[model samples]
Target: MNISHLENQTFNPSTFLLTGFLGLEYAHRWISLPFCFIYMTVILGNCTILHVIRTDSSLHEPMYYFLAMLALTDLGLCLTTLPTVLGIFWFDAREIPFSACFTQLFFIHSLSLVESSVLLSMAFDRFVAICNPLRYGSILTTQRIVTMALAFAFRSFSLIVPLPLLLRRFHYCRTNVLSHSYCLHLEIMKLACSDIIVNHIYGLTVVAFTVGIDSLLIFLSYVFILKTVLSIASREERLKAFNTCVSHICAVLLFYVPMIGLSLIHRFGERAPHIVHILMSYVYLLAPPLMNPVVYSIKTKQIRQRILKKLCAVKLIQT
Candidate 1:
């Protein structure tokens, strides 16, 4: 198409393009390898965690229930972007239909919000376990766990439903080129020809109320946990109490640190190097799913032993 014809194109285009990385076109094949590895790790790791939890009757507790929920969320988050991202890197399939783009955007952000909420629930799990040992079972009963899981799903669905709908009402006259490898609300909204003040406002408001508040509550929960740990008279008891939370603490930091960094870079580092944004985005999306299972496996004795036993049984059968 001629330049003039392209410029005069209608606002309601059928497809949108995703530019994975600006200057890395030559290295798309190589880059996709690592991403493929990461995706495999994420899927296998979370699935293993879920499988182990399901098979172990001793793990039929509130903490493991929350953990199963977290694993499911991680699976959702990774799968939401995996298809389109790998397609761009491997097959040059960057043109996404308008409706599919909105659907991907919805799942990605909603799963992220769900993950943040799951982390907060895990923090509360730790807090109750550490702060009220005797009442832990009474507080986080099976019924309560089911209720919380349903609530989390409902809240995420409610908040994320309006985002794509809001964007659908906008007119897109500019080139519908997205910066990242996948569809996101802010990135997609940036292509709109019409005003997006409300979009921007609502996006920020959602992040603040959901992720922002979740982060604050997680930190506060840790603060109380530390206080409770310090009150114990014996040094070994204090250490033991803190040790139980070490895996969760690592998971929290792995998740939120990159997430917050990416948010800050997006808002303030307009002039930052492109690679910085790409790396931060990858870390934010990939780290938790890949690391959570490893962390829990190494730190939680029950899971570790069960995994070892299962491995041995498989090895024996093969031999």
Candidate 2:
């Protein structure tokens, strides 16, 4: 199958987006250290959370299972972009090979989509557990959870597979300097010499189908949750329900708010500062992973206690 007309293009941008304030040209030293720190924290924190979820027997429920999946996705996400991003910052290799760039775009986008779907599933699980307590087990059975997880994976891969292939269809005739650290779809689309009408339409369509749909469903789930809480006769039950969801709500906002902002900024804030855009991108991608563990530990007593016990055990072993 013939793909992407490899006409052998070269890019000659004096400065990449990471280099400084867009084309304004600023020092790389300032951003590099901070970016490195963020990348390390994201990787290590998510890995720790993943390990906790895996080894803790009490956390075998649907909630923690989904949380582990979230950590896994975030880990993949960091691996997808951060290493190349750091390389670009630390080293000066702005020229990404066409094939490798497209592949990076594929995994990053696929994992992001999967994260959104998984969040939606988590919201649905919460709704069932809080609103229909008796049916929670039957509704979210182990088999059903596995099926949902598989569906999330399949959907993400299916949506993103088309993007790289579509990008591969085009010839690299013009600028190869990706504006952002990684090879995002929008950045590549902008670089294409041919008519990008199909690319834009297809990209927007998928975004709407995946991100938009998932976000809306999450909103609706919270709506039902709120209604159920309001109608409950016992104030204790209502408070418990609300408390249980606080962490998930925080995580959802951390994930989607920046995403929505980034989309809006990319679409509408064209004249805005490039630094602003770059900062927003980092927050959108990194903030969720950073906040997730904190949210869980703060809101879920069991997780908090388990983490504390582990900390104390380490201290005792040291002593």
Candidate 3:
């Protein structure tokens, strides 16, 4: 197995194999049924959210704007994950090109951070609406939302840009079998034959600065929001003020719980079953996008009413 001849040139493989759920090869097709359904639901649900938000003038506010951003990010996640996931489940097409693999990994990681950023923005939005109701409009104008969106996207890209390049410098000569259907930075990095201390450091740094800091900010924003809500004397007022935050709290939990679960499993579940890893990764990728729209639509009165109105209009037209 001496790749001595590769020393003259380089030893980068042309493709990396993506692994789906293991020991369930007999049920891969059955597994694909839920995945297909999840993909379709994500598309329909997020598209419905985007359409509802765009077409309704009454819904044009900072809250819905951030929700729209969330929808877009969810769609981005869906697109990035769908190809490799379905490829593995349905077609057994797991041999992703090195470049394509890196690109997929980048978007998967980047969009998660963007989603984190959006959630943080939404938290702040809640804090403003609850804690500073009078000046909310001035603080979170459309212009500022756009600016924040741009800044978040750029920050995610900048923080993640080094990953592929760092990975490129290493020569991967080990088994290219990856644990999940999609390319993950750590999973791929593990295949390299060289020292990966730097990669590990940089990866940890990115997670800390992006997801760590953002989640902390979101928690603090909610603390302030809770404090403000408590100051309101009337029980009715307290409930009403707290109600505005319910959808956001659900969204945050949806996005972060699976994420934190998967992270913990990766760090501490080394002796755990491989299927546990695959299942955790699946939840990490699929749950948030598939569930966010449902949560928001059910929780947010305006979005629910708008969706119902649109559905009724369609029904009337069809009739």
Q: Predicted candidate 3: what Cα RMSD to the true structure?
A: 4.0
TM accuracy, model 2 = 0.91
Q: What lDDT tens digits, residue by residue, belong to model 1 across residues 182-265?
A: 887877787898999998899899989988899999999999999999999999999998988998899889888988898888
Q: Which whole-number lDDT from 0 to 100 does residue 232 have in model 3?
A: 93
Cα-based lDDT at residue 100, candidate 3: 93
For candidate 3, what is the lDDT? 0.89
Best of the candidates, lDDT: 3
Comparing 1 and 2 on lDDT, the stronger one? 1
Candidate order by lDDT, decreasing, is 3, 1, 2
Worst 10 residues of 2 by lDDT: 1-10
Name the runs in model 2 displaced over 4 angstroms.
1-26
Candidate with maximal TM-score: 3
Off by over 4 Å in 1: 1-12
Tens-digit lDDT track of model 3 for 1-319: 1223223233337777777766676688999998899999999999999999999999899999999999999999999989889887888786788899999989999999999999999999999999999999999999999999999999999899999989888887766677788988988888899999999999999999999999999999988988888889999999988888998898899899999988888778888888788888988888888989999999899999999999999999999
TM-score of each: 0.94, 0.91, 0.95
User: lDDT per prediction?
Assistant: 0.86, 0.79, 0.89
Question: What are the per-residue Cα lDDT tens digits for candidate 2 across 203-280?
Answer: 999999999999999999999999999999999988988998998899899999999888889889989876687778
Model 3 misplaced stretches (Cα beyond 4 Å): 1-12
